[model samples]
Target: MQIETGVSLKPYNTFGLPAVAQTLVRIEADADVRRVLGDATLGRAPKFVLGGGSNIVLTRDVSQLVLKVEVPGRRVVDERADAWIVEAGGGENWHDFVTWTLDQGLPGLENLALIPGTVGASPVQNIGAYGVELKDRFDTLDAVDLITGRSVRLDASMCRFGYRDSIFKQALAGKSLITRVRFRLPKPWQPVLGYLDLERKMAETGQHQPTARQVYDWICEIRRAKLPDWTVMGNAGSFFKNPVVTEDQCRDIIGRDPEIVHYPMPDGTYKLAAGWLIDACGWKGKSIGRAGVYEKQALVLINRGGAIGAEVVTLARAIQESVYGRFGIRLEPEPLVI
Candidate 1:
């Protein structure tokens, strides 16, 4: 409930970038929500919602109100024979939520293991990994309408999920604040290992149909091996989204670079692996000043110790130019830069 001015954001963000928020408010409860936003003295101002601070790039000091969503709780409101409906507060840490669900023997969320972010922001970006996305198990969500100053609950259909996107990031955009999320999880089990990493791990382990917990552990291992930890080394995960291209464009890209890995969509279009394209473009592991690309994964840009936000943005732009020039595909940044 404490509101501070010009607070140092080095601890809040994983990248360790020292960006300052003009006014930072941490709302611990639902009551605190209106109390902070309705303050007459603060007046109307630009604001950014910060969660676990993953999936974002703090490129510069934000001269606006930064409302750090901290409203937190959970409830096993409904239970069935096959699956259970578990609800979590918006401020609940994403990994903690996953761990708690796993301990409860809940299925479905095992594939989302170790993803660093807040539960409130999950639906906003429709976070995904391996072969699963949040939308796959989405039941419903409750959010506060920023304009109406009222709470609302939306179902899976209303979310309009698509390739790491949702109504929150599209139609709803910045007009609402997610207060709670409900997930329909299976009680029994079903481990999806269709992805290359899981499949490869299964082969190495000489086992098939591993338990949900096992899948979680394996995924955590795989992610740690490729993605750098933001605590020690600075990074915002994958910097660019995989470009979904037309069939002809895909062919043109593949014709020149046959080694380009692609995922074919059900809609007939193809998604070019952004990491492969960036790595192939000779930008992978390449550093300019302090900001540079991660060596293991080409899609991630790292802040090597003291990299400035402007420098990071510049490097990202450079990568975009490279990818666009090489494949005629414009790469889009995944981070919500403020």
Candidate 2:
């Protein structure tokens, strides 16, 4: 564990805000992880675990030690007749993991390519893109409790997966740092043709069903074109979780705005397309100070340059208020705010 005092977290976070960490520890090796956690000194509680820094925004300087996981390793745990068990260090870049699976002739993760984050943080949000989510392939994760310094394994069921939520993201929020993640991949996959853009892209390309690699490439292209690169600009990925509504609520939104898009939920509910709602509310290109909704995707809030976290949160609230005022639906943030 390499410890640095009073570290500026601008580069660590995708938001590019100048929040400072009271203590920043970058753990690379397994021993390094144990050393940091088991150390008697630097007795910081309520630590913040930062991965690729995409799915989070620090509203203010983190008042505790920030443990930025950097342990990197990848391996195939087992290969059965149809499935492959893939394990990665918590800190491995998520896109690279997808790329690795594709290279290994794995198929299920194709629809989720190019999502920016580390492997450990994926399960916390149960991250989804196009039509695939981490929960679909998530096997388990190893996390350590901050209070007890105890390690534990949480299986898929124990995770309590939901739309952009899990136990880790909620009850254990900012209190556990995941050290490893395991995912089940398929050598022979059940292809997901659920996303409209992907289905249309497949049709436009004159192929009924492209290969897993092809789907991966297409989705990456779509995401690249749709989202602003945080590396070039700055953002914490999609800032708001698409609001889920009841069946009756859906009817109301549809009655008011027939063009409202919705996806049916298994629980007899409906999820309003947040992008559609924001676009309908005319917030696509709205900008306030350095924080602004991405011009292309209304759901994605961007940090155009140097921006403050509070200002960004304010802009997000404004949009949330706008959508709520019009549709009677409340939007919740997807990112972990500190």
Candidate 3:
């Protein structure tokens, strides 16, 4: 395999932070991983797996070997009586794959439309939007062990999925490269319209029972209006995850700040709106160096033209500190920092 050195990662990551990979290799298939393991120098070196570059904040140049996963394929693998099973390569663009499923008459992925990232990265973070998460439709995934070069297939239970988390972010973090993922879209599709934005979309259109296509279109519209376009603004969408607090903790905060935005989880926990907390702390349209809180949505931290990774981290830290100081809830960032 040919190695590329001194590659600029600015265009690769959504944040557009300046960083360089000293050595990089494109893993187009599982064989590519095994090939690297068989190599002498590359095999012994630490490796960093990169996907669509959507959920990362590059803080410095990488000395470890960078495996840029580019494996590619997509198709309906099975049409069972209960569901249609779809599979896509890890390298495929996630949004495009979702659109493809819709085009093929599969309605399960409509809620996840327009989420930026590759298919391989989805399960790692359990990406979700508009009241639906990747875990809901996940069937199985094939991945290769980075060190052993052995391939393994994991079902949904083995993934240990949680709110924006999975085994890939825990026990197997940085230890494997996902090759492909399969999704099970159940028959008789149901629209997930519980989210406030989707409910508003329903109210506006007067379509209480929306088809999958309608839901997909509404989600895309809602995201476009709320989230900054990464191509234009250079931001990792939703800089912080919504913090889930216990019912008593939520009540305490609600009593102190009557207008605090929150939602009750089925598990009896309360998920506080991180954006609302940051906005309440007066972070919107504020900047620390070149990094700034997005004026339209406080949850997103943007690179205000030519910003460095450290500046973004600094701005995020300031937001966290302020939110914790005011609300006594520490905000956790969503993106992986490296």
Candidate 4:
């Protein structure tokens, strides 16, 4: 375990928000986590597990011990007639891992291409895009308990994955650190192209029967066109989760606003586009202090150069209030505000 003190976390987090970690420990393996837990001085202190820093907003200097996951490795763990089981270190770059799987002739992860963050953070957020969520492809994960330092393997059901959430974000939040994750990529790989953007790509390119690589390229293209590069501009991809509502609630809102963008779910509910709601509320390109909504996509909040966490929070709160007032639906933020 490599330890540092008074570390400036701006470079670590994608938001580029100013914050200092009083104590930061780089955990490269399960043993590294155990070592930190075994340390007399560090063991008892409150801890925060950090992955790629893609899905978080650091609102202030973190006083608790920060464990930066840096575990590394990826491989085809098992192969069978029905599926291919792939495993990756928690610290592995999510998008890079997805690309690697495709390079190795594994195709299931293609639709998740270009998503920012580490593999460990994937299950925590139950990250999804283009109609595919991490839970759909997940097999099992190994995590070490924060208090006991004992490693445990958990299955998909144990994770209790829901829309953009999982056990990691709930009962296991900050209580354990994921070291590795495995995915079951099924055989006869079928492409998931039901999302509107993928459909549009198919129509535009006349490649309805695209391969896995084609789907990966298409997903990358779609995301790049919509979301800002975190390196160039400090921001999380999406600031709010698309709110799902009952059929009656959706119909009630649709009656007043016929142009609202919504998708019917298998459960007979509706997933209203959070970006559309924000844009309709006149928040697109709007700013509060140094934090501003991305002009191209209302779903994103950008740090307009030297913006602090408070500014982002202030801006987000204002947008949330406006969206709730207009739609009668509360927009939940996707990022973990620290």
- List residue ranges in candidate 4 displaced over 4 A: none
Better of 2 and 4 by TM-score: 4
lDDT of 4 by residue, 164-257 (tens): 9999889988899999999999998999999999999999999989999999999999899999999999998999999999999999999999
Better of 1 and 2 by lDDT: 1
Pairs with steric clashes in candidate 1: none
Which segments of model 2 are wrong by more than 4 Å? none
Regions more than 4 Å wrong, model 1: none
Give the candidate order by descending lDDT: 4, 3, 1, 2
Clashes of each: 0, 0, 0, 0
- Estimate, for each residue in 1-338, the C-alpha lDDT of model 3 and write its tens digit: 46799999898999999999998999999999999989999999999999989999999999999999899999999999999999999999999999999999999999999999999999999999878999999999999999899999999999999999999999999999999999999998888889888888889999999999999999999889889999998998998999999999999999999999999999999999999999999999999999999998999999889999999999999999999999899988999999
Clashing pairs in 4: none
Judging by lDDT, tell me the better candidate of 2 and 3. 3
lDDT of 1 by residue, 63-131 (tens): 867878887887787888977999998899988999898887776888888788899989988988888
Q: How does each model score on lDDT?
A: 0.84, 0.84, 0.94, 0.95
TM-score of each: 0.95, 0.96, 0.99, 0.99
lDDT of 1 at 107: 68
| Model 1 backbone overlap count | 0
Report the C-alpha lDDT of model 2 over 1-338, residue by residue, as the tens digit.
78998998888888888788888899775566567767777554557788888877888888877889987889888888977888998899999989998897767888888888898888988999877889898888888776666778999999999889999877887777788898988657777877888888878998776888888888888989888888888987778888888888889879989988899988999877888888888999888888988889988999878889888988988998998898888899888777
TM-score, structure 1 vs. true = 0.95
